[model samples]
Target: METIIREDTPKTPYVKLDGEKGVVEIKGRSIPENSVEFYKPLIDWIDEYGDDPKDNTIINIQLEYFNTSSSKCILDIFKKLELLFKKGFKVQVNWYYEEDDEDMFEAGEDYQSIINLPFKMIEMEE
Candidate 1:
């Protein structure tokens, strides 16, 4: 499987999905005008990656901010990871949030609670 890379825009995050290494990274903002359209390909890629996933999958999420629509799309991404985790794949989500950003930290906690995958809340220097 080829690696999926997408540049970051003012309304979207920089995405890097490496199928060979099983590493997924999404950094920057995520408030796209059409969240569903923006995230569809990403979700689909995860589905395809699931078919032949690496032994260990690491997901790093570092979003400065996201709108309501993006929130749902983010959850969809997590759900995909959960499926892999349930299948006994070693999966980890590193949720990075600015130390001073309470909302972002709470959002990570919320996702951790919802998804069955192991998540690590990382406090980034502001």
Candidate 2:
């Protein structure tokens, strides 16, 4: 599968989906006007990657901020990964939040509670 690389824009986040490395990264801000449209390809890519996934998959998310719609789109991505995990694949989410950002930390915690997968809450320096 081909890797998906999207640079961050004012209303979108940077995304890198590397099937070879089994790594999915989403960074920066995600506030797209049409969140679903913006994330559809990524979600589809995850679905495709699930077919012949690597032994271990790591998702690194380091978002400065995101709108509610983007949050749902993110959850959709996680749901895809959760399916992979249920199939006995090694999948993990590394949610990186800046130190002292209570909202971001809590957001990660919320996702951890909702998703059936291992999540590492990483604190980065602001």
Q: Could you estimate the TM-score for every candidate?
A: 0.98, 0.99
What would the per-residue lDDT of candidate 1 be over residues 1-126, giving only the tens digit for each residue? 989999999999999999989999999999988999999999999999999999999999999999999999999999998999999999999999998999999999889788898989999986
Give the runs in model 2 whose Cα sits over 4 Å from its true position: none
RMSD of every candidate to native, in Å, equals 0.6, 0.5
Go through the candidates in order and give the clash count of each.
0, 0
Which lDDT tens digits does candidate 2 get at residues 26-68?
9999998899999999999999999999999999999999999
Clashing pairs in model 1, backbone N/Cα/C closer than 3 A: none
Q: Candidate 1's C-alpha lDDT?
A: 0.94
